[model samples]
Each structure stands twice: as C-alpha cells, then as structure tokens.
Target: MPRGEKSAYTDKQKRQAEHIEESEREQGRSKEDAERIAWATVNKQDGGGKKSGSGRAKPH
Candidate 1:
C-alpha cells in the first residue's frame, strides 16, 4: 500500500502532519510542493526509490 495509508498515521503523527501542512500552506507551498514533499519523503524512506519493496509481486 502507498504511504498515505490511514493506519500509518497515528494521532500524534496526524497532528504533526497537519501542522506542517498548514505551515506549508502559509508558505505558499502550492500543489506541486505538497506532491514533491510527499514523494520525496516516501522515496527517501524507501531507499530513494518509488516503492518500499522491489517491483515484484509477492510469492504465493
């Protein structure tokens, strides 16, 4: 699943996320800014790649 998974966002994390978002809003982050931030965070955490795991299906 993608990083935006609701289960991943705890109450504390949610608050922090919202604060940063609102601050970004004030800073005029723009749509592209939000997208880039999300993509960069996810990619950085995922070894600078687009996905968390290798691009392969799970073995059944």
Candidate 2:
C-alpha cells in the first residue's frame, strides 16, 4: 500500500480517527494538524492497520 492509504484500516479504526480529528478541530487544531494527530493517535493505539499481526492478538 502507498503511504497515507487507509485501505488496510478497519471500519472501527476509521471511525475512531474521524472522531479524534473532530475533537482536535474542536480544540482549535488546524484541519491538517487535526487529521495528522488523529491518525497518529490511532496508529499509536492500534499500531497501524489491521493487516499487521502484531496488534491483533486479544484475549477473548
């Protein structure tokens, strides 16, 4: 995948990013900054897209 392509992200991840971006905007961050921060936050939490096996392991 190309850089900045979100095709590997799950629906939930996308939703979370969108929400984070909106929150950052509400807090006065610039549009570009908000988007960057949102994706960064998501990556920090989820460790990038779901195609990676590292962050997908969870206890049931």
Best by TM-score: 2
Deviating ranges (above 4 Å) for candidate 1: 35-60
Q: List the residue pairs that clash in candidate 1.
A: none
* Lowest-sum lDDT 10-residue window in model 2: 51-60
lDDT of 1 by residue, 1-60 (tens): 686454544455445555655666677788667655654554344334323446777445
Give one digit per residue, the lDDT tens place, for model 2 in 1-60: 899999989999999999999999999999999999999999989778876566766545
* TM-score for each of the candidates: 0.47, 0.83
lDDT of each: 0.53, 0.93
Candidate 2's C-alpha runs over 4 A off are: 52-60
Candidate 2 achieves a global lDDT of: 0.93
